[model samples]
Target: MGVRFSKFPLCWWPSSIKSNLHDMSDIDDGNKNEKDHLPGFTEYSLDQLRSTTSGFSPDNIVSEHGEKAPNVVYKGVLEDDRWIAVKRFNKSAWPDSRQFLEEARAVGQLRNERLANLIGCCCEGEERLLVAEFMPNETLSKHLFHWETQPMKWAMRLRVALYLAQALDFCSSKGRALYHDLNAYRILFDQDGNPRLSCFGLMKNSRDGASYSTNLAFTPPEYLRTGRITPESVIYSFGTLLLDLLSGKHIPPSHALDLIRSKNFLPLIDSCLEGHFSNDDGTELVRLASRCLQYEPRERPNAKSLVTALTPLQKETWVPSYVLMGIPDGSASSNQSLSLTPFGEACFRRDFTAIHEILEKLGYKDDEDVANELSFQMWTNQIQETLTSKKHGDSAFRAKDFSTAIDRYTQFIDAGTMVSPTVYARRCFCYLMNQMPQEALGDAMQAQSVSPTWPTAFYLQAAALFSLGMDNDAQESLKDGTTLETRENRN
Candidate 1:
């Protein structure tokens, strides 16, 4: 049987706990009325959540560990058909509904590309659930161990370390530094096939009891002694993760340190990664891992330091995370569908200099007539409406209201009036902020088509391309933008 906690009657609980439970009705009503101002977070009604998970059916449970546990996770599809993972906390896990909401809200507010963004939460009486963006790809554990397919590549492993460290850094920055459990299972892959740390790990331990699935040997020393976790303890766990990546198996930190001391890391390394990494690369990683595994919490380096150390060790910064994960490049087929005019063709190849030469040959060098012709083709009323919408969009964009910006920009674009490349570029940036990379790339392309010489267009294109896992193309586009910017400045 799964671990079980002793049941307690409501009368036996503390006054504060009882008060918290009594206030749940008010809290639920307030949350329902308030808009989810927090980006990447939502507050789902219990009915909405139930519909998503088909009443939390047994088949919906995706936790490899099992569903009978206090904290059970179910994979669900939202009403809009967006995939999500709903984590349901049993009554034994969180008796205080308010505490659960507070903790869930705190974690939900943390927004980072490296994190599996929290969609929302549900707190109604005894039911407490956390809804997070679903990851189609399984956890890092499945990929690292018990592999049915090819083993993870060395470069991908290195990238995962950097991503996880960056994720931790973001959480630390937001004052949610204490991760409940940091392990391979905590890393998940998104639709784009990029690895993201599960935000559920950010939830603090319950007042009722401490919880840890791994053996005590794998846990931090402080947690074993004091039953409390600190930020530094996270670093120690990160070290264990690094060891898992290197060895392809769970090895005790003490034993891993011993192997590192003997300079016998080759045996510890995953044989699948043989010949993929150099001796120096392996040595540097082992050294970093050793620092993280320090018995004393204060001895371990911070996440920022880990990022700095790992940055140089990354041999291919231009390779996108999806590519590193062996995901098939979707951008290639998308690129094929784009019907490129001559100028668009040049932009596609990232040939800014060639584009400039062609434009000059065509006698279109910043010509007033060309600008006027492009800028003045619409009726005054339509122009005024477009401008009004654009003004609102720009205001929203500047304020970081990406959803509002997207809606307003869509209105402006659909108005069918000619606008400046800057408008398209701005909308593209908003798309990027909203995690709509494909739409961002589309807008970037439109910007380039409208104004081929615009440096910002190429720059936005590069960013969009990089996000879509077309890194080589992104680099070329970035170079083109730099060249265009430098030339314009020189003139």
Candidate 2:
């Protein structure tokens, strides 16, 4: 038996939690942590990560450059409803597991409001992954260059520069002085639209030997000459980011410096930012950028100095980031809650009429495998029997015959000829309708087991948990379902 550790004894847990834990324990065997790590740094399992990210579906990918990126990052939701960003390194990226874990542990220890903090790492077998808090708004690249709503306001751009400087300063203070490829894409906006630096770039992909992905001209001068990254290299990269924020596009550091030297700033500034910033404020920012891009690494200002220089330049100090960016404030209760789907709304309102129509509209499409199998396996009596039972259960479900639906679904499940999450989900709703909260929870758990990433299973669990009076747990489950549903719709 695996050694299990819990802060509280079994008797201390609520009856609902205890029962759910007992029912789901067996399904979690493959998701156990491989080994313990530093305090507060979780060592997640491959299986758990897979389920959280829907087997790393391409549709859930959040990293820029798509498949071509050296490492791909996906957005996922944890069981407890926390959103996470999972970074899966390339197969050959981190060949040394020990080195990978050490690096992860070191970076995981440092946390601040300025960063998308690292929460966990998975290093089981050949897989190497890092998990961090998800930033919802998007990257600086999108907001600065590819904005849909509007160009990021001048005040927001200044805030980004200051925030990034503070983040680098925090890392530097924590003894992690070097940050790889500090670019606009490396900066992300959290749910509140506040900018935070991604922690993924803190860990070097050592095995690859290539550190910088962008143009060599934008890279630190020392790195170009010796192929080595230093603390000053990060500052040099930071200069490029300031230029990106100011110009609304990438400007080669050399070209930008010459423009600054000649006092010809009009061509370097973004047209979108024409009247937003004063000439004096613009000149001050340009001078700071020049200092960061000095030819000699030693002459470059450190992270602390950058923070010092940029602190006084902040605009709209009292304005919230969301307001400045023209986005909804995430802290607002209305924005915090996700908009429910039609089927989800029907379930939430306990509207049997709308539920029946949705079920009919959905039909067996959710169980396409079962429909396809009948074409080739009609001669097999077991397959035929299983399909017939499911059809009957679905009919009963749509007809609002909860008791009959339960009986038919039970028969289909016990047969073991076929497995379908949709069957378990439909039966779960039936159990809820019949006021069998425990049975509803059981069926919902089973549906999750059958299809580990399905949002419907989580939604069903929320309903059952609510009926059981586990209000907090029900809300968590509801949030998890909403998160998964959002990802599915994006696909």
The best candidate in terms of TM-score: 1
Candidate 1: what lDDT?
Answer: 0.73
RMSD of each: 17.7, 18.3
lDDT of 1 by residue, 339-445 (tens): 44454456456454554344335432332222533345465447888878988987786666878988997888777664456667677777777787777776766
Lowest summed-lDDT stretch of 10 residues in model 2? 29-38
lDDT of 2: 0.78
**Model 2 alpha-carbon miss at residue 466, Å:** 30
For each predicted model, how many residue pairs clash, with residues at least 3 apart or on different chains?
2, 0
lDDT of 2 by residue, 251-293 (tens): 9999999999899998789998888899988898899899999
Which runs of model 1 end up more than 4 angstroms from their true locations?
A: 1-40, 328-491
Per-model C-alpha lDDT, please? 0.73, 0.78
**Could you tell me the lDDT of residue 291 within candidate 2?**
92
